[model samples]
Structure formats: C-alpha cells, structure tokens
Target: MDFSLTNEQELFQQMIRDFAENEVKPLAAEVDDLERFPIETVEKMAKIGIMGIPIPKQYGGAGGNNLMYAMAVEELSVVCATTGVIVSAHTSLCAAPILENGTEAQKQKYLPKLASGEWVGAFGLTEPNAGTDAAGQQTIAVEDGDNYIINGSKIFITNAEFAHVYVIFAMTDKSKGTRGISAFIIEKDTPGFSIGKKEKKMGIRGSATCELIFENVVIPKENLLGKLHKGFGIAMKTLDGGRIGIAAQALGIAQGAISETVKYVKERKQFGRPISGFQNTQFQLADMNTKTEASRMLVRKAANKKDKKLPYSVDAAMAKLYAAETAMEVTNKAVQLHGGYGYTREYPVERMMRDAKITEIYEGTSEVQRMVISANMLK
Candidate 1:
C-alpha cells in the first residue's frame, strides 16, 4: 500500500499553501478581530478556480478530484478556519448535492454558475427543533399550481448571508415523518424568502452563518431536487462528503497549532535554555505531532474512498471523530505551551483554539460520528 500524493496533488497543495500564506494569513487576524467575512479573498479564490476544484470541466469547474478538494480545505484551514468552512459548506454541502442528485436540466442550469462562482451556494437543513433529530423538521411545503409554497425558517445555515443559491429541505407530508422530507433548489431572490440576522458565534466568526426565513416563498416544480420524499437520504449522503471536509479542517487546525508551538518553544528561553531543551515540551510536541499525523491518515483514507466511489460513510465518521478530537486536544496543548501569552489575542493559537471547537460540533458532532460508527459496526 503506497501512500503518497500524486505529482498533481502536490502541486495543488503548494499552490493553495502559497495562496494561504500570501493572501489569507495576512487578513485572518483581522477577519477574526472584526468578525468580518473575507469576501475579497473568496473572489480571488474563485478566479483561481479554488471555488470548484472537484467539479468537472464541462461544468466550469477545475476538474480536480475529491482528494484535491480535501487538500484545498486543509491548506486554507491551516491559516484561516473560517475561510476553510466557507469553501467546505459551499462545495461539499451545497454544490456536491446538486452534482450528485440533480436532473440533467437542473445540473446544466445551476452547476455552471455555481462552479464558476457566479453564484455562491448554501444548504438549509437544521432548524430550531430539528437539529440532531432531523425528522422533527417543522418547515412545510404545500403544492400549488406549477409551484410549491414553502413556509418556515431554518437556523444555523452557513453561507446564508450572501449565497445566491440554497439547497433547502422541508416536509411535504408530515405524516410520513422522515420520508415526508423533500429537497429543493431555491434562489435567494425568490419572493418572501429572506435571510435573518447573522449569528454571533464563538468561533469561525467570519464564516457567514444566519437564519433562513421562507414565508410562503414560491418555487416552480422544476426546483424540486431528486425524488420526492427522498430528501433525508440526500442530506445524509451530502453529509458523508461534508464530514471528510471537516476532518481535513480539523487536521489543518492541529497542524497549524503545532507549527506555532514549535516555533515558540524553539525561541523562548527557560531555566537558562530554550524551552525546546526541556523533555516535557519535547514529549508534548511528540504526542501532538503523532495524533495529528494519525488524523491526516484517516482524513486521506476517507477522501480516497470517496474518490473511488466506494461506501465511505463509516470511513468518514471515523475520520471526523478522531480528527475533531485531536484538533481540540492539540490546540489546548498549544495554548499551554505558549504559557500566559497563549491566552491573549496577540497569539494566533488562542484563535486557533476557538476555531478547533466547531469542527467537533458541525458536519456531525463528535457524538453523532460515534453513533454512525457504532451503528455500522453493530449492524
């Protein structure tokens, strides 16, 4: 079993790393400090084709694969996790669903614009009462002549503020429970559809997260995505891919924290020598690196399975669970190694620690990932 990045993957990684260092790292602190979305950087990435790395060239994407997409997310996350999630939610959560499930007409109509970054996309599945219990969705859609009238709201929708397209879910038949759910492709400009106030989050603040309100919003029947009453399956499959993206993000966060700590320990003197001279610091760094490397292996394995079109639900679950836990643990240790300085905004590690937390919560919480893995094992 040879484990190596192909030459193309290596080149793509270098390109993204350089872009992150030159374009993203400079603004990361300010983006966090002011809770500002780096829209300009996003535009720059679109122009560079980072926006649609995995989509086919016919659809105006860069024609890369899932592995490349995961690598892009990892590299972006190393410098700025908010930016990482922007791409992840856009590509994995939104665009991927359409690519995988949409009809040819739907694909031709939407994928080109989405792939070109002419339109940013978002997914709306979670709601006030529906979170982990997705079957509890209260959003309703009633069929009308040539259209559907949707009424309800979704909370915690990433990319909600500026997304031009949304892949939304609602109940068409509440009696059917999860089977009642259906997905739709709704445009942002549809009448009575509006974005609510943005959430002030604990971390990844620069990522646009807000509520989606659909007050009798009307969309044509053509907007119905996939088979009716199969939205839950679509959502689950989409999240399988999304979990891989989050795993990569977690791995990158761990790597970034390690990089910062290593530089600090090598420079800071203690007891007449650099802290790097201390065995405790050495041991801690060793553990952090080991855990992070393990996370990388898991992330890559899941991504490879996806690229090969294999069943990867279990693979993604394990990757996300381990990587998210590793991120939190490593970032905490990174703070400790920085001493009092780590507690302050002067050091990026503090922000990194904050960013590491969301990886455990979204895409599927660590608890949820465990459930997925265990359920598969028991089955």
Candidate 2:
C-alpha cells in the first residue's frame, strides 16, 4: 500500500503549517492566558480554507481529503492545541454526520454555512451522567406536530458558546435503551436553548467548553438527523471519525514538545557540558521522537482507512490510544528536560503539558479506546 502523501497533500500541509506559524502561533499564549477564544485568528483560518479542509468544494469547502485534514490539525496543534480542536470538532463531529446521514435538503441547508465558516459547529452527546456511557441519554425529545420539543443538558460541550449550529442527541423512547436515542440539529437561538456554566479548563482553554441547556426548545421536524430512534449508531460512528482528529491533535502536541525539548537540551548545560551531550538526555530525546513518529504513523493509518472508505473504527481506537498516551509522555518529558522553567508558565513546555493531558481524556478516554480495540479484536 502506498504510504506517501500526494503532492497536493504535501502542499496543503505546508500551506497550513505556514499559516499556523504566522497567525495562530502568535495568539497561543494570549488565548491561554486570557482563557478567551481567538475569534480573529479563527476568522483568518476560515478565510484560508483551513476551517473546511476535508469538506468538498461543492459545499463551500476546500475539497480536501481526511489525511490532509489530519495533517492540518497536526500542524496547527504543534503551535496551538485549541486551534487544532476547533477545526477538528467542526469537521469531524458536526459536519461529518450531516454529510453522511442528512437528507439532500438538510445537507443543502447546513453544509455550506458550516463549511464557509459563516457558522461554527458543535456536537452534544455527553451529559452529566452520560460520557463513555453515551447510551444513557436523559435528554428527551417529544414530537409536537412538525416540531420536536427538546429538554436536556449537555456538559463539557466544546464550542458551546460560539457555535451557531449544534448536532444534539436525546432519548425519543427511553424503554428501548440505546436504540431509543435520536439525534437532532438544533440552532443556538432556538427558544429555551441557552448556554450554561462555562468551564475553566486546565488546558486548551480557548476551545470553549460549556454546559448546553435545552429546556423545552422547539425545532423543526425536518431537523431530525439520520433515521429516528437510530442516533446511538450515529453518535458512535461520529466518534469513530472524531477519534482520528484527536489522535492527530495528540501527535502534533507530542511533536511540539519534542521540538522544544531538543532545543532546550542543546542550550541547557549541566556539569559544564551541554545537556544534549549527556547520554541520558540523548536517550530521552530519542524515546520522545520515536514515540511521536509512531503516533504519526498510526494517526495516518487511521486517516488512510477512513479516506479509502474502509472500516476504520478499530484503527481510530488504536491511533487515539497510542497517540494520546504519547502526547502525555512526551510533554511530561519536555517539562522535565526544561527543569525549573518547565514548572512555570514562563516556558511553553508547562502550557503544552497541560494541553497534552486533555487529549487522553476527551473524545474517548484511554481506557475506552482499549475496550474498543479489544472488542474489535475479539470479534
């Protein structure tokens, strides 16, 4: 099988890398310090077609492939994890389901706006009680003629405050358990739909995680995504793709840490010699870069499977598990190599360490990924 990127893909990567370095990188520290979303920088990303990297051109997007999208996320993540997630969530979670399952009219209505960056997108599957147990959806949707009245809350929702559109899930028939759940397309301005408490996160603070409260919110019946009572499948499938994005994000975070750590080691002296000259430091850098390379390959393998329309859930699980763990490991070492400076915000390593952590927790936890891989392997 071919493992090399096409020329077009390479160009896309280079262009995005340049943009991230020049634009998003400048704001990374400020965004984290202020805990504010960098709307201006995101607008710049959108204008450059980075926001819709994997979307087809017919839908107001750049008409890129998933692997290219992964590369783009990785490049942005190398500088700003928040920017990486913002693009990742928009493409993988929100736009993907609609593109894959929506009716022609639904696609015509939503995809262009999301792709054009006229509106950012969000997915709402997690609740206070439902995280890895996505089936335990307490949110209920009652049919009312041409409208569905939705009442539920989603916690830890990314892009909740700034998103104009959301893909949400709720129980239509509780007795049926997971099968009874259904997904919907809900607008932020819908009556009874409001933002709840904003979370102060430990990392990727600019990504905007918040509680999404829907109290008797009414939406058109036309907004029902996929088949009714079949949204549990949609939610699971959406995450299969989402995991690839998170893995790419993790891989990028690790790459960033190693690049910084290598520089620090060479310049940092111990025992009257450069730290890089020490065998111990050499081995540490070797391990960090080796793990990062492995993570990149896994992420790309998953992306390739996805792009080829092959079964990719298992590949995605493996990629996310390995890459996220690698991110945590590599970033931890980066801080250690930086010594006292790593412990303080004066260095990027400290911030990167914090950012590296969430990759393991969100999307699917490392434990959840193992379960997915094991289940698939057993099957």
Candidate 3:
C-alpha cells in the first residue's frame, strides 16, 4: 500500500500549514483570550476551499477525499483547535449528512451555501440529557400538514449561535426508541427558533458552542433528511466521518505540543547547560515524538480506509480514541517539560493541554471508542 501523499494532497497540506502559521497562529492567543470567534479567519478558510475539503466539487467544495480533509484539519488544528473544529463540524457533521442521505432538493438548497461558507452549519444531536445516549433524545418533532413542529432544546451545540443552518435529530416515534428518531434541516430564521446562552468552555474558546432552543418551531415537510425513522443511522454514520476529523485534530495538537516543547528544551538552560542535555528531558521528548507519530499513523490508516470506501468505523474509533488520549498525554508532558513556565498562559503548551482534553470527550469518548472497536472485532 502507498503511504505517501499524492502531489495534490501534499500541496494542499502545505497550503494549509502556511496559512495556519502565517495567519491563524499569530491570532490564536488573542482569540483564546477574548473567547471571540474569528469570523475573518473563518471566511478566509472558506474562500480558500479549506472549509469544504471533502465535499464534492459539484456542491462548491474542494472535491477532495477524506484523507485530504484530515490533512487540512490537522494543519489548522496545529495552530488553532477552534478553527479546526469549526471546519470539521461544518464539513463532517453538518454537510456530510445532507450530502450522503438528503434528496436532490435538500442537497441543492443546503450544500452550496454551507460548502462555500456563505453560511455556517451546525449539528444538534446532543441534548441536555442525551450525549453519549443519543438514542434517548427527548426532542420531539410532530408531523403537521406540510410541516413539522419541533419542540426541544439542544445543548453544547457547536457553532449554534452563528450557524445559518442546522441538522437536528428529534424523536418522531417514542415507541421505536432509536429507530423513532428523525433528522431535519432547519434554517436559522425558522419561526420560534432562538439561541440560548453561549457556553463558556474550558478550551477551543473561539469555536462558539451554545444552546439551540426550538419552541414549537415549524419547518417545511421537505426539510426532512433521509427516510422517516432512519435518523439514528444517519447520525451514527455522520459521527463515523466526524471521528476521523477529531483524530486529525488530536494529531495536530500533539504535533504542536511536541514542536514547542522541543524548542523550549533546547533554548532553556539548566545546570550550566541547555535542558536538552538532560537525560530526563531527552527521554520525555523521545517518548512524546514516538507516541505522536504512532497516533498519526493510526489516523492516516483510518483516512485511507475512508477514501477507499472500505469499512472504517472501527479504524476511525481507534484513531480518535488513541490519538485524543495521546494528545492529552503528550501535552501534559510538554507542560511538565516547560517546568513552571508551562503552567502560565505565557506558554502555548498550557493552552494546548487544555485543548487536548476535549478531544477525548467529544466525537465519542475514549470509553465509547473502545466499545465500538471491541464490538466490530466480534462481528
């Protein structure tokens, strides 16, 4: 199997890396400090087609494959996790479902604007009560003549406040449990749709997560995505793609931490020599590099599977689980390697360590990933 990136993919990766370093990285600290969304940078990303990496060209996307998308995400995430997630949620969670399952009219109505970043997109699967237990969603959508009245609240919704479109899951038949769920594409200006409080998150502060409340919101019947009572499968399939992006994000964070730690160790002197001369520091760096590379390989393997249209659910889960945990571990070590300086906001590693924690929590937790992998093995 070929391990090398095609020239086009390599060029795409370099372009993103250059953009991140020159544009996103310099502003990252300010964005994190103010907890403000970088709309200008996001627009730039969209204009450059990074926002729609995996989407089809006919839909105004980059016409790229999953591996290329992962590479772009990793490059952005290396500088700013917030930017990374914004693009990921839009491309992976929001647009992907509509592209994969929506009817022609649905795709025509949503994909172009979302893919071009004319409007942001969000996914609403996690309700206040249903996170990992998404099948237990209490949000309800009742069918009416030519429309559906949705009434429920979704919490921790990424990009909810700024998004112009949302793909939401609601229970249409409680008796069917998971099968009872249905998906809808709701525009932001729909009647009775409103934004709730924005969450003050611990990290990825620039990515706006908020509560989305639908109070008897009415949407056209044509807005339904996929067949009735099939949203659970759609949600899970979207997440399968999302997991790969999350793993790429984790890989980026780990790479950033390792790069920074190496610089610090070489420059900071201790005991009449550079810290790099110390055996402990050397060993720490070695371990971090090794683990990060391993995580990267896992992510690439999963992305390859996705590109080939092979079964990748287990690979995606493993990559996300291991890479996210590795990010946490590597960032922790990076902070330690920085000694007292690491704890201070003066260092990027501190922020990186904070950013790394969420990867393990979202896109299926580490525990959930293990279950997915194990279950797939038994099949």
Candidate 4:
C-alpha cells in the first residue's frame, strides 16, 4: 500500500504549516499567557477554508476528505494546540455528525453556515455528572406541543461562548438508558440557554472552555438530530472520529516539541560543547523522533481508514492512546533537554507540555481507548 501523500494533500499540508508559522505562532504565546481566545487567528483560518475541510462543497465546505482534515489539524497544532482543537471540535464533533445524520432540511439550514465558518460549532456531551459515563445523562428534554423543553446543564464545553451552533444530547426517555438518549441542534440564541464563566485551564488556554446551562430551553421538534433514542450511537460514532482528530493533535504536539528541542540542542552549549554533540542527547532525540514517527503513522492510518469508509473505531482508539502518551513523554523529555529554560514560559515547549496532557484525558481517556481496543479484540 502506498504511504505517500498525494500532491494535493502535500500542498495542503505545506500551506497550513506555513500559515501556522506565519500567523498562528505569532500569537500563540500571548494567547496562552493571557488565556485569550485568538478570534483573529480563527477568522484567518476560516478565510482559508480550514474550518470545514471535510464537509462537501455543495454545503459550502472545501469538499476535502478526513485525511486532509487530519493534516490541517496536525499542522495547526504544531504551533498552537488551542487552534488545532477549535477546528477539530468544530469539524469532527459538530459538522461531520450533522452532515452524516441530519435530515435534508437540517443540513440545508446548518451546513452552509458551519462550512463557511460564519457559525462556529461545538458539541455538548460531557456534563457535570456524565463525563466518561456518557450514558449517565441527566439532561432531560420533554416533548411539548411542536417543541421540546430542555432543562439541564453541560460542563467542560469547548467553544461555549464563541460557537454559534451546538450539537446537544439529552435524555428523551430515561427508562431506556443509553437507548433513551437523543440529539438536537440548538442555536446560541435559543431562550434560557446560557454560557457559564470560562474555566481557568492548565493549557490550551486560548480556546474558550466553559459550561452550558439550559433551563426550560425550547426548540422545535424538527431540531431533533436523528431518530429518537439513537443519539447514543451517533455520539459514539462522532467520538470515534473525534479521537482521530485528538490523535492528530497529540502527534502535532509531539512533533512540535521535538522540533523545538532539536533546534535548542544544536545551539545550547554545555561542558565546552554543544549538547547535540553528546551521546545522551543524540539518543534521546533518536527515541523522540522514532516514537513521534510511529504516532504519525498510527494517526494517518486511522484517517485513511476513515477516508475509505472502513471500520476505524479500533484504529482511532489505538492512535489516540499511543499518540497522547507519546506527546506527554516527548514533551517531558523536551523540557529536560531545555534544562531550566524549559520549565519557564520562556520556551514554547513548556506550554506544549501543558497542552499535551489534555489529549490523554479528553475525547475518551487512554484507559477508555484500551477498553475499546480490548473489547473489540476479545469479541
């Protein structure tokens, strides 16, 4: 099987990499330092069609595939993980699901705005009590005349205040457990729907993360995303794709850390010589590069499988698990290589290290990934 990227894919990768270095990198440090959302940078990404890489052109997207989307996320992440995740959550978690499951009318109404980046999108799944236990949903949506009254809240929502559209899940029939769940499309202006204060996070601080509060929020029955009681399956499927995006983010963080470390080692002098001249540094760099390369292959393999419309749940799980760990490990070594400087905000590696951590924790933890892999294997 050919592992080479097509010419178009290669060009897209280069284009995004250049954009990250020229535009996104300039504000990354400030964004992290001030915990500011880089709205301008996001606007730039949108202008370049980065917002909807995988959505169809007829729907106002670039008509790219999953591989291109993964590549775009990776390149952006190398400079700023916050930027990477914003696009990832928008594309993989929100737009893709609607494109796949929304009724024709829903698609016609939402996809154009989402694809054009006129409407930033977010997913609302994790709640105060329902994080990894997605089936343990407490949010309730009661069917009213021609509308559903939603009353519950979600915690740890990304793009909370910034998103224009949200894919929300709630319990339509508590008696059915996971089968009772359902999905809906809620606009930001919907009455009684509000965003909570932003959370002070350890990393990726530039991305807005907050809580979503719904109190007697009302929406038309037509807002139902898919068949009632099948939202669990839709969420699981969406997360399978989301894991691939996170795996790409992890791969980018690792690669970025390595890149920073390589430049520093060649210039940093110790004991009358450059650190790159030392056998220890050389070995460490070798190990870091090897592991990062492996992560890239795994991430791309998952993307390729998804592009082929093949079963990629296990592949995505493996990619996210290994790549997330590698990002953390490589960033740790990158800090050590930088010595005292790495510990401070003086270098981007420290922030990269901080950003790498969430990848392992979110979008299904490493433990969750193992469960997915093992369950499929044993079955």
Candidate 5:
C-alpha cells in the first residue's frame, strides 16, 4: 500500500505546525501557570478549523480525513497538551460517536454546533465505580413518559466543566449486563444536572476536567443515541477512535521533549565541552528520534486503517500503548539529560514529563491497551 502523504495532507500538516509554533507555544506556559482554559486560543483553533478536522464539511467541519486529524493533534500537542486534549475529546470521544451512530435528528441537533466549536462536547462513560469495565456502569436511565430520568455521577470527564453537550451512558436494564447500557445526549443546562468541583490534575492543567452529576435528570426520548441497549458498543467504538488521537498526543509530547533535550545538550557545557559531544547524550538523542518516528508511523497506520473502514481496534490500542509509554520514557530521559534543570518548572521538559504520564493513564490505561491488543491477537 502507498504510504506517502497527499498534497492536501502535507499542506494541512504544515499549517498546524506553523500555528502551534507561532501561536500556541507562546501562551502555553501562562495558561498552565494560571490554570486558565485559554478560550481565546480555542476559538482561534475553531476559526482555523482545527477543532473539527475529521468531520465532513456539511457538519460544519474542515472536511479532512483521519490522518489530517492525527497530524493536527500531534502538532497542537507538541505546543500544548491541554489544547490537544480539548480537541481530541471533542472530536473523537464526542463527535465521532454521534457521527457514527446517531439518528439524523441527533446529528442535525448537535453535530453542527460541536463541529463549528460554537459549543464544546463531552463524552461520559467512566464512573466512580467503573472505568475500564465500562460495561459495569452504574449510572441508570429509566424510561418516563417520552423522557428518561438519568441518575448517577461521572468522574474524570474531560471538558465536563465547560461542555455545552454531553454523550452519556447509563444502564437501561440491569439483567442484560453490557447490552443493557444505553447512550443519551444530555444538555448541560438541563434541570437536576450539575457539575461537581473541577479536578486538580497532575498535568494538562489548562484543560478542564470535572465530575458530572445527574440527579433524576430528564432527557427527551429523541435524545437517545442509537438504539437502546446498544450504548456499550457506541462507547467502545468511540474510544477506539479516541485512542488514535491520544497516541498522536503522546507522539507530540515526546517530540517536544526530544526537541528541548537536543537544544539543551547542544548549548550545555559539561566538563569543558558541550554535552552534545558526549557519546551517551548522542545515543540517547538517537534513540529518542527513532522512537518518536516509530510512534508517528503507528498513529498514521491506525488512522489510515480507520479511514479505510478496516478493523483498527488492535492498531489503535498498540499505537496508544507504545506511544504513551514512549512519551514517558523519552520525557524522563529528557529530564535526565538536562540534569538538575529538568526537574524544575524553568524547563518545559518537566511539564512535558508530567503531561506524558496522563496519556498512559487516561483514554484506557496502558495496561488496558495491552489487554485490548492481546485480546484482538487471540481472536
């Protein structure tokens, strides 16, 4: 199969790279320090169509392919992982499910606004009691005369605090186990729906994450996403798509750490000579470059498979697992290469290290990714 990027893909990658370096990098530190959402930058991304890269133009997106989406995610992540998570959560977790499974009315009601970035979208699957076992979700939705009353809380939801819409999952039948779970579209302002306190996270500080509390929240029957008892399938499919974006985010963070390490080694003098002159440092840089390239290729392969409508669950899982672990490893080495400076906030490598850790933990933990890959292999 041909692997070269088309002219359009090349131009798209260049555009994202230029925007990240010129616009995002400048304000990343300030946003992180202040724990601000960077709404202005998010709006700018929307204007440039980075917020909806993979959706069709008719849905108010840039009408690009999954590869373009991954490239944009990587570039944005290199500059600011917070921005990358924002877009990834919006596109893959939220919009992808609706695009893939929603009825026409659901799409018409939600997709355009989410695609245009007029309002942010969030996906709710993980609960305080259930995470990797999403089928064990405790959130319940009971049918009530043309509406469903949802009751439960979702923890660790990305963009939960600021999102205008949410694609939520709740159990409709306890006896059916995984098949009992169903998906619903719930608006943020609906009665009995409120957000809990924002989570103080280890990294990606500029991205907002919070708890979603649903206390007998009523939603119209029309808001049901896909068929009842089919939410588990939708959630899994959505997460498979999300894994590719997370993998790209990991690649971007690794790239950023490596780039910083390279600059530091070149200018840092150790024992009367530049550290870059040391064979050990050179070997570390070489290994980092190789791993980063490999991670990028894995992400591209998974994305291409997704574009072709092929079974990409294994590819996506492998990409996320390898790339996230790679990010952690590279960032740790970057810190070591920088010596004492790497441990301080004075260097971006430290922050990158913290950001890299979450990539492994969220969007399915590294362990979960391994399980997915192994399960696929066994089949």
Candidate 6:
C-alpha cells in the first residue's frame, strides 16, 4: 500500500495550513476574547472552497473526498477550533444528510447553495431531554394541507442563529419510538421559526450555540429529507461521520498546544538553562507529541473508511474517544510546561487547552463513543 499523499491532496493541505496561520490564527485570540464570530473569514474560507471540502463538484463543492475534508478541518483547528466546527457542522451534519438521503430535487435545490456557502447549514436534533435519547423526540410535526406544521424546540444547537438552512428532526408518529421520527429541511426564512436562548459555552466561543423554537412552522412536503420515520437512523449515521471531524479537530488542538509548548520551553529559561533541557520536560514533550501522532492516525483511519464507504461507525467512535482524551491530556501538559503563563491569556496554550475540551463533549460524548465502540465489538 502507498502512503504518499496525492499531489492535489498535498497542495490542498499546504494551502489550508498557510491560510490558517495567516488568516485564521491571527484573529483566533481576539475572537475568543470577544466571543465574536468571524463572518468575513468564514466567507473567505467559502471562497477558497474550505466550506465544501468533501462535497462533490456538481453541487458547487471543492470535489474533495472525506480524507481531504479531515485534513482541512485539522489545519483550521490548529489555529481556531471555532472555524473548524463551523465547517464541520455544515458539512458532516447538514450537507452530508441531504446529499445522502435527499430526493434528487432536494439535492438540486439545497446542495449547490450549501456547497457554495451562499446558505449556511445547521443541524437540529438535540432537545432538552432528547440529546442521547434521540428517540424521545418531543418536537412534533402534524400533517397539514400540503405541509407539516411543526411545534417543538431544540437546545444546544451549533450554528443556530447563523445558519440559513436547518436539517430538523421531529416526531411524525409518536407511538413508533425511534421509527416515529422524520427529518425536514427548514429554511431560516420560514415563518414561526425563531431563535430562543443562547448558550455561553466553556469553549468554542466564536461558534454560536443556542435554542431553536419552532411554533406551528409550516414546512412544505417537498422538504422532507428522506423516507418518513427514518430520521433516527439518519441522525445516528450522520453522527458517526461527524465524530471524524471532532477527532481531527482534537488532533489539531493537541498539536497546536504541544508545538507552542515546545517553542516556549526552548526559549524559556529556568535556573541557569532553558527549561527544555530538563529531562522531565523532554519526557512530557515526547508524550504529547506521541499522542498527537496517534490521534492523527485514528482520524485518518476513520476518514479513509468513510471515503471508501466501508463500515466506519466503530472506527469513528474509537477515533473520537481516543483523540478527545489525547487532546485533554496533551493540552494539560502544554499548560504545565508553560507554568503560570499557560494559565493566563498571555499565551495561546491556555486558549488551546480551553478549545480542546468540547471535542470530548459534542458529536457524541467520550462516554457515548465508548459505548459505540463496545457495542461494535460485540457485533
């Protein structure tokens, strides 16, 4: 088997790395400091086709595969996890489902705009009580003349206020449990669809996380994403792919932290010599770098499986679980290596540490990833 990257993939990776360092990294601290979303930069990324890395060219995307998408997320995340998640949620959660399950007309209608970044996409599945238990969908959609009238709410939605299109799941037949669910494409301009409370998160501050309240929102029948009552399957499968993005994101964060710490130790002196000269510091750096490399392998493994259309659920779960823990460990050590300066905003390690956390929380918690992995093992 060959290990070398194709010329196109290598060039794409380098371009994204250069863009992240020059464009995104410079604004990362300020965005974190102010909790401000960098709309202009996101649009710039759209122009460069980062927004549609895995989307097919026919849909106005970059025509790259899942591996390319993973690399792009990793590069963006090294400088700014917020940007990483923004692109991830749009591609993995929203566009992916439409591409997979959408009717030909639905794809023709939504994919181009989504791929072009003319419309930002968001996924709405989690409700107050329906997070892990997706079958407990409280949002109900009733059949109306030529449409479905939906009334329910979703909390902890990323890209809630910023998204122009939302892939929402609601209960169409309450008695059927998971099979009772259905997915719909709801445009942001639809009447009765409104933004609710906003969540101030511990990390990924620049990415909007908020509530979506739909009250008697009328959605045309043509917007139904897939077979009726198949949304639970859709959501679960989409999450498998989304986890790959989080894994890559975590990998990049760990790398960013270790890289910063390495530079700091070489330049920072203690007693009479640079701290990096100490055996303990060298050991810690070694561990961090090792974990970073391992996490990258896991992410790439998952991405490759996805691109090949192979069974990737187990792979994704393993990757996400390991990578998230790796991020937490590596970032913690990076902070320790930097001493008090790492705890403060004076350095990027502190922010890197903060950003690494959500990789364990969203796209399925680390605990959930373990369950997924274990379940697959039995299967």
Provide C-alpha RMSD values for all models, in order. Answer: 0.7, 0.8, 0.8, 0.7, 1.0, 0.9
Reference-based lDDT, residue 23, model 6: 95
Off by over 4 Å in 4: none
Which should have the higher TM-score, number 1 or number 5? 1
Task: Report lDDT per candidate.
Answer: 0.93, 0.92, 0.91, 0.94, 0.91, 0.91
Q: For each candidate, how many residue pairs have backbone atoms clashing (under 3 Å)?
A: 0, 0, 0, 0, 0, 0
Q: After superposition, how far is residue 269 of candidate 5 from its true place, in Å?
A: 0.8
TM-score of 1: 0.99
Over 4 Å off, model 1 = none
Segments in model 5 whose C-alpha atoms lie over 4 Å from true places: none
Whole-model alpha-carbon lDDT for candidate 3: 0.91
Error of 5 at 354 (Å): 0.1
RMSD (Cα, Å) of model 1: 0.7
Top candidate on lDDT is: 4
| Candidate 3 residue-wise lDDT, 1-379, digit = tens | 7878789878887898899999899988888889988899989988988877888989888788899888888888888888888888988899999999999998888888988999899999998789999987999999999999999999988888889999999999999999999999999999899999999988999888999999999998999999999999999999999999999999999999998999999999988999999999999999999988998889999999988999999999999998999999999999999999999999999999999999999879999999999998898
Estimate, for each residue in 154-188, the C-alpha lDDT of model 1 and write its tens digit: 99998899799999999999999999999999998
Error of 2 at 244 (Å): 0.6
- The candidate with the higher lDDT, 1 or 4, is 4
Clashing pairs in 1: none
Model 2 residue pairs with clashes: none
lDDT, residue 266, model 6: 98
